[model samples]
Target chain A: MTADTTRRQLLAGGAALGWFCINGSWLQSTPAQAQADGFAPQHLSVAQCSAMNVIADALVPGAHVAGIAAYIDSQLSAKNDSLLLVKYLGVPTTAQSGFYRPALDSCIRLLAADGMTPQLALTAMGEDAVSDWQGPPASFFSFVLRADALDVVYGTEQGFARLDIPYRAHITPKKPW
Target chain B: MSNALSTDTVIVGAGAAGLLLAARLAESGRRVTVLEAGPKRSTDDLISSQIWARRLKWSGPQVEELGDHKVGHAFNAGFGTGGSALHHYGVWLRLHPGDFRVASDHGVGLDWPIDYQTLQPHYDKIQSEVGLSGDADAEIWRPEGAAYPMPPMPLFAQARILQKGFEKTGRRTAPLPLAINSQPYQGRAACQFDGWCDAGCPIGALANPLVTHLPRAQKAGVQFEHNALVSRVLRDPNKAARIRGVEYFQGGERHTITAKDVIIAAFTVQSARILLSSAADTTPAPGNRFDQLGRYLTSHPAATVFGLFDEPTYPHQGVSGGQLLSHDDYDNKQQGNGFGSSQWLIAHAIKPHDLLGYGTGRPDIVGNQLEPWLQDAAQHLANMTLVVEDIAAPNNRVTLSDATDTHGIALARTEHNLDARTARLWQQRIDEGQEIMRAARAREVWHGPRVAMHIMGGTVMGKDEQQSVTDSFGRVHDTDNLYVSGPSLFPSSGAVNPTFTLSAIASRQAEHLITQQ
Candidate 1:
């Protein structure tokens, strides 16, 4: 094919190619199915994922269905290719796991105590009232988690539609996150 | 070590400025070679996904940042061929006439060695060449320049709603001058208003260096070396007056290249990093004779105000840079309790994710309330960003980091703190922004944190060698052959986007270089 023809094809096939590339091994197991069937996170532990899910669901309802834990895990696993907004805020790619791991661990420990609801836990985080919390900062961690929750819950076309907004895409995404 | 190569001109950082200069110089029959620290990218790589677009951002050596207002280096800079312009929102605005004489007019901030009149011809030339779309006459705050080649982009529902707010507040607004094509121009397709500009414009609708300058440079026979991180500029051992070439790392090996002239166009921090790292045992870095190599770093303090209007306004129907602009408060540098200029970019096309995303804006609305709040905002949200000019404090600077990268080169360490007056100006504008939002009959209004945007200075241009690193023509004050291009040469932060001004400076520099040769 001519260069012009190839360029046109690439432009037309951009979304499809991106979808396949991102899905890679997860194509067979949709985000919903993975969440339903107890998705195995590659980088995060079970407890870490559990805490992330609870906190994310608290920050953004339907985040569990949107696969917030899976999204964070996938992005963290990508390392340098991470789409986490924290990358734009000073935290380097090499130290990205360091930023998330300890914070999630702190969340798990904090929530493991009796009668700790996601709302109360988040409130405590906002107030820096969590005892023995071992991550960056309770308030900052909550902010970052809240941002991540938003990403998975409303960063896609279907997500936009869920909020009654039009996904007027020049090049449409093949699948929602 | 790899065998040394030679070229007529060696330009570090294949960014907007670098590519533009390379194209012009090569077209004028001078051999040019550009060394880029990141990978090579094409329009094909410019996907619509924000996650995938992260690949376009700066992923090189970490820049250690300190101070109250740390420049968002990684966020503001791009990685590959097009540099930061790859993902830029294409808000092409020229600096005002008063902006060039900040110190003289307002008795605050440094003044530009060259005035707006000196750069006006180049601005007009670049606008014609690159094709900016806007109603030039409507920009009452604009400096004198040629009329825009194309008419302004059509106002979306969000913009129309926000324009009412500006009108109600008795402030004037004009269609934001954008490098984005409003209609098919110079064979490129018109913009689709996809609002995926941060992901890079795959189509040639946005005039990024990928489509605008890189291709022209290639056509003009300018050579490019991607994944080539230039460590430092080399000087002749015998002659202290002249530069020999540059040392770089590629494919896990060190290499050297000799050139007649060297231009460091790496976006702000890294460009400063290269010069600061070049200090030898006997001699200081090329332009550090007066100990002013990495001084006078500045970044615009910016924030966004979001409001929920009763009207159904689709906020995602335009470019990310915004649909309209209000510069009514821009020229008045000495406004109440503050001493700097400020402008409002109204009704930007917003996303749900990322830093400026609408969903990310309200952290308080959570749990069961999250969905409803997001749903309301998705339709009714109208937002505007306030860009406040930062004073060029000498202490706010870029220094060499004690820590070294794997390649054994010291990383760039940036220290930037906003002046008290500048902070007051930011707060003042943000307060007025909410008032304007409420005047438009909004139910709720809130603002984002004050963060730095569009970094400038570090190797500032001035007439005095002791006060600046480069001359008005971007030539290093002390060195004859060494030049610094891009926003790093800016003497002041002018409450406007720096791309147009930087491009014009590069265009002027290209002319000077060709003439000198």
Candidate 2:
């Protein structure tokens, strides 16, 4: 098959293909099943979420490998008790983030309306390729998306740079009693 | 039931000073109990987008004020066991030696009876226990003190960029001494360097009270009563001079906790409120005889300069306040100006919502056309900002509002009350910061209006009984066994975060209180 044909087929069979995309161990050890896990319902559509993932990857470039979006989504969808970011930064309202989903939906819809797919739209949008998809109001949506991106990229093990990991680099220990 | 909560000492407020004091006291076989007004929070509560955590703040029954700018917000202290420390950005710096004697030196603000040298050892002790990460060797501008316990937190794209500007302009930028682990130490993990510290850390990496000190205090059998709002300090009929106990309300129940001594670890604002609320009957009037309880209050009004860069600074990679600092030029109090010293907190990676949005004074903007800007901001996280300090003014005080609430306690009234001299001082620092940013090859440079920082100088510590409310050791002049801790003891709002100095002061007071007992 041609590259475009295969791409279309992959897109059409995304649910099946996504099975391999998720590491089996991670799926099994999902936070939902963890004793401390408080789960929130996933409210967005596949198309909308795929758009967010693509845009987030473009925002940080290395975010997917860093597993940032998953982390952001986890914190966003987890039980209020399980999510720590809300408590620390005082995100104003914990019941609703007020920015994440609506911003994601707007970006996807605007980009899609301009005759671009989710992935291509995000990459093109970065280069200022699509003029019509100006994203959210100048600073507000930018703030939410930037925080979400960082929540994923920097909040993760790779993101925190594993510097916090004990037994890795021992330095200047306190005198024991 | 009394046996359920027994301790040699009970510390109120669970911020940096209280937590450190509790840990140190607990180490010496003292059973310590900390009563916090906020909720009981942990790292797990930090990462969620939940609403309750954000609602953890001090909102008296109702607030009535007359000013364009309302001083007290609904959420002031974190409504958890950790207190406001849960939301603090871990930028740890000692107040300058001169900061201790502001009135004596410049004749501008009230003078602290004790000098910085007196608090130096405590600074060292807290730094050692907390594990500060910074390049002590490079901080030539820093005053005499023991070196930081750990190497500096790694400089990111923004620090490197900002350093170049400082070099180009003949200015200086050193690694900010942070109470975050650069490498694993003290049985706790180091900073993950996620820059999400303002949001709280989940892995117990940052030296927040809950993770670092409170846990140890608990291990040493320190009992904590969360969600307890202390209403007033009740005195006995016989020794109306000495505090008998504290009257508090929790879960809609009015209860009294008797103690030999009462330590007000509540923050400057709340501490002043509690004093004002109780002194209504005890002192024959609110802010009675001395007129010193909450009159000379001041919070270091800070301004920030943001510099945008083309490179991917990844500002979100490190601490919320960033890695590098600029105090070499700003630390000196300008001559002939009534302003005290001012310092620079650089490369702070602000979140788009609060940091970039509300902080920049543009909280209203929302809707479409935001994604592209965010895409750019994510890559350019390496931008820099300067937390320029403002001078102390007595008029910049916290007062009890005449308007009473459902609970009958008065609300906190505040006015920005900045002086012309301090306003000029802010302008000078902003100009210098702008020049530094321009030298660094920034595409755009802008500064935010001055915003208030860690509380200061309401119930100041002094030598003379007539001038101040508390003595140098934080003991009330007339009332025995009533001690105050934290920034409320600050004689001046020096141009630095008060957490470190407050810790040192609290430690000193705790030693005195222990001996006096």
Off by over 4 Å in 1: A1-32, A36-39, A172-177
Off by over 4 Å in 2: A1-177, B1-8, B48-76, B280-288, B335-338, B357-369, B404-406
Candidate 1 residue-wise lDDT, A9-83, digit = tens: 322322322111132354444454455556677788878988888988887766666667777777778777777
Native-to-model Cα distance after best TM-score fit, residue B517 in candidate 2, in Å:
2.9
lDDT, residue B299, candidate 1: 94
lDDT of 2 by residue, A1-177 (tens): 243442332223212111011322333222212111222224444455556656655554333343334444555554443232333232423433354566566676656675665446544444445444443442344444444554443332322332121111112111000
The 10-residue segment with the lowest total lDDT in model 1 chain B: B46-55
Tens-digit lDDT string for candidate 2 (B1-517): 1322334566678777778777777776777777877677766666521122343444334333333222333334555666677767778888777777666766677777887788898888888877788887888878788999899888778788888988998877789999888898888787776656655666667777878788878787777887777777776668766777676667776766777777788887777777777774445322235677776666665667767788767665667766788787555676355355677777765544333431222322122223334445555644455444445555666678886644556766655566677766777778888888888888877777665556566677888765677888887776877777888778777777877888788778767766765
**What DockQ would you assign to candidate 2?**
0.04
lDDT of every model, 2 decimals? 0.86, 0.61
Report the Cα lDDT for residue B188, model 1: 91
